[model samples]
Target chain A: MKINPEFVTSVITKFIREELNKFGFNRAVLGLSGGLDSTVCAFLAVRALGQDNVLTLIMPYGQTFPQDVEDAKAVVSLLQCRAMIIDIQPMVDAYFHRYPTDNPVLKGNKMARERMAILYDFSAREKALILGTSNKTELLIGYGTIHGDMACGLNPIGDLYKTQIRQLAIWLGVPEKIRNKVPTAGLWPGQTDEGEIGLTYEEIDKILFELVDLRRSRQEVIASGFDPKKVNLVWEMIKRSEFKRRMPPIIKLSSRTVGHDFLYPYDWDK
Target chain B: MKVVLVQFSPHLGLLDKNLDLHYQFIDRALEEKADLIIFPELSLTGYTLKDLISEVALNPRKNNQLNRLKSYSHKIDIVVGIVEEGNPGLFYNSAVYYSKGEILAIHRKVFLPTFGLFEEGKFFATGRNFKTFPTPFGQVGLLICRDFLHYGASYCLLAGKADLIIILSAAPGRGMSENSGFTSSEMWELMGAAISRFSTAFVLYCNRVGFEDGVVFAGGSFIYDPWGKCLLRGPDIEPAFLSLELELEDLRRARKTWSFLRDDKPEIILNSLQNLLAKNED
Candidate 1:
């Protein structure tokens, strides 16, 4: 389905402002990775909370590409917001030296966690709420490092698919260089999201629009000119990554446990 | 008949701004060649108006606020919700149907919910009439918000030979089902399906979105055919407009297959109700 970018921008900005006001905070902090998703989130945060109230923390590991850091700095300068870059190599090296591993997956997860650890520290120091950057596609397929890039006080782009993000980014007047660049987690060199996920975002978004929004069945999707293997693969990813979308399940020993039979809303007082 | 169901977020207590939006939606509908366009309850003024009800009430004679819409109805039929001024002190939550530069029918809300989050009964007078009027397509019935929640209202419309039932609601989104989401929207969908099938009439439900005083309106507007088949559905929690071409023949086909209206015994129902009222009085 086509979306009206003007309408979406107004509603999102209003939502961010209203939600922050309800929580009695006006400042927001976000990790600016120079990727499309984080750039879009930062843009919305700046619009909602103003440039003075927004702070972008550009934390990069030793292995991160220099071009990515430059792109992040360009965004900060364009928005005219406060920014700080903390080289995360020392922190990551300290931990990896104690628990040495040759696996890239382990190293990637460690770097992600280290960036988040520094982000939370700045969040506390600056008294700003942490904004999230993960999009719906990555969250659905478990492509993100949980408790790292996924941790945030609130997320503005989590509901938007990767294709929708591109549409919104252009509408929000995000720089074309960052918007047109390849999508990546920046966890390692030469790593791209679509390559690892084995599907183009255009192909996946259409399938996801049918699967998640329309709630179509697998056979229905396959019958609609989609390959059976891709449909099955995407469906499996969504099902398996369901845990990443929710809170940790609590063992309910009592009748009313948190997130169980008895529950209260977060804004009960307000 | 081609129909358009609109689900929009109205700014509370802003008549001029809301009318501008109404005109825009109407123009869009005209471009789509829609025969009829329906909007949510309180289309002119958002819901959750605690004390501003009287301030936003429109007088039928004095208020020319809807003249543009009435003129636009020369090419399309328009059904919208507005707060109406009755007497010096009486106001009503009402639905107005306009066609061919004239007000065809007005259905004041019969059920004014007062408990819980709703305070409509406290500020507005209840309607005493349930009627249907003729349109270019067929006989059409109108209900506002809580009126469609009561079964008797739909029965009255059916008894009046209405082939199309239109309801406007500002229902809030509440409760998430384990597998699905937005239970209230699902309930409204079920109501639309059942009413359309049982009465052998097309049902159109339009609900609004947006937040007012912390209450969020759930927007899942839809249009259903006589056989309980949904033709179009609006998005939830977002402002949306949907246009669909409906086959008027479906009413006749569904009635012929089921014959529910032909076998209906309204006289028996009226007599039983009268007898029960007499016994209660004695």
Candidate 2:
């Protein structure tokens, strides 16, 4: 009867801790994006591994919004956790010059990947688990950059939808300003998520829930006026991005494959 | 209970030929003092039977074949694949587990492959759930080739449910590789791990060999312990009977070393599988 934020956070935090213990890992590292998703993950990680155990890293491009940095600082200060802030603008610019692309999506992707490279470098240095912050909504829509914002040793919020992210952020006590900020990657100037997509998270959330959570077909989704084009857009995105969800597609040269040919997920060598 | 795996090759549409081979295997198993003998998927007729399967399907009420199998059940249990004759247009690629003078259980193949070299969907329907039949040794779970691949079957079996997982496979050699592909090795390992990690139980995979309609049957039959350790594996191209001595202590030792059932995140596993399936469905 009581659907509350703390209840969700408590459940999520306990599960992560138990899974880590089961996996035989003691500490975890999380990228502190200063966004709602990452803030919630940071809070959960703290409960899972303690303030001393969960290292927070804030990697900012020099071009990143000032508010984003302020929010990252707020998380570190409030959680009383150790954090390292690294400016990647110079390094990313160097690569960008070589790439020479006007495409924002491609550029944003490269930045995301660069941040992950730094995150992994820190993970090796600290010997801590890389905790991912992408929520189910972003993952489902293929919104986050693969091997970038998507790279992590384990994901905690990968199943929760975007609306669920807002709720959990409130439960985790992420600062109101960051929580309410137009869910942006802070990839470019004058950018809000809906500005590029032409539809707000609320609408996307409703359509996605109706389609996936409720198991509605394409026709049913269209009948509901969720925009046949948008539904098709989401479908195409998922189809094209499936490669990201799985291991490199099996090139079957043997009697069986790990994926489709002789399919099984268990490691036989063990 | 001593479980005997009758991993034999079934020629296409040759019911009497396959049944005769089954009779020989069953007789040998009985003489060897085994408590039960199991066969691969579609053992009465091979997998490539397709539409012809429904025509040859023995009507259940008027079936003399199953009634014949019931006579032998007083001595030992038998789990064999059969066409459980349904209505005129419907029949199941079913594994009929018979014991004590009656059919104990029937599990239909759920993951029917519609694409690729196989076209099983044209012939049979998918089963809805994992069915477990009780035995003196433990509750036995039955599955066809693709049914075992559904890892959710592992969770359902682990809920203090089954002690033996009997898989009847005409298991084709498709995308299995040692490192990164589909191979018979992957299926064996997954099934072994599922049985081992889920609880104290033995997994028996009886896969047929030889080509059926150009689909090469990979004859890698095996039995696994509850710890997921391989108890036995037969040759990849032969009709062989593989066996392992299973005792309460053996099950107990596996349970002690790693109590996977005790440590399982049932709720998490449930959610993860759902999300995994949902993605695939999309």
DockQ for all candidate structures vs. native: 0.03, 0.01
TM-score of chain A of each: 0.97, 0.90
Residue B234 in candidate 2, Cα distance off native in Å = 43
> How close to the true structure is residue A1 of candidate 2, measured as C-alpha lDDT?
9
lDDT of 2: 0.74
The sequence of per-residue lDDT tens digits that candidate 1 reaches over residues B186-269 is 888988888888899999999998766555677888888888888888877778888888899888889989888888888988
* Candidate 2: residue A60 Cα off by (Å): 0.7
For model 1, name the residue pairs that clash: none
lDDT (0-100) at residue A94 of candidate 1? 93
* Candidate 1 local distance difference test against the native: 0.84
Identify the runs in model 2 with alpha carbons over 4 angstroms from their true place.
Answer: A1-7, A261-270, B1-282
lDDT of 1 by residue, A102-205 (tens): 98889888888887888888888887888888988888888888888898887777777888888889989999999999998875799888888899888888
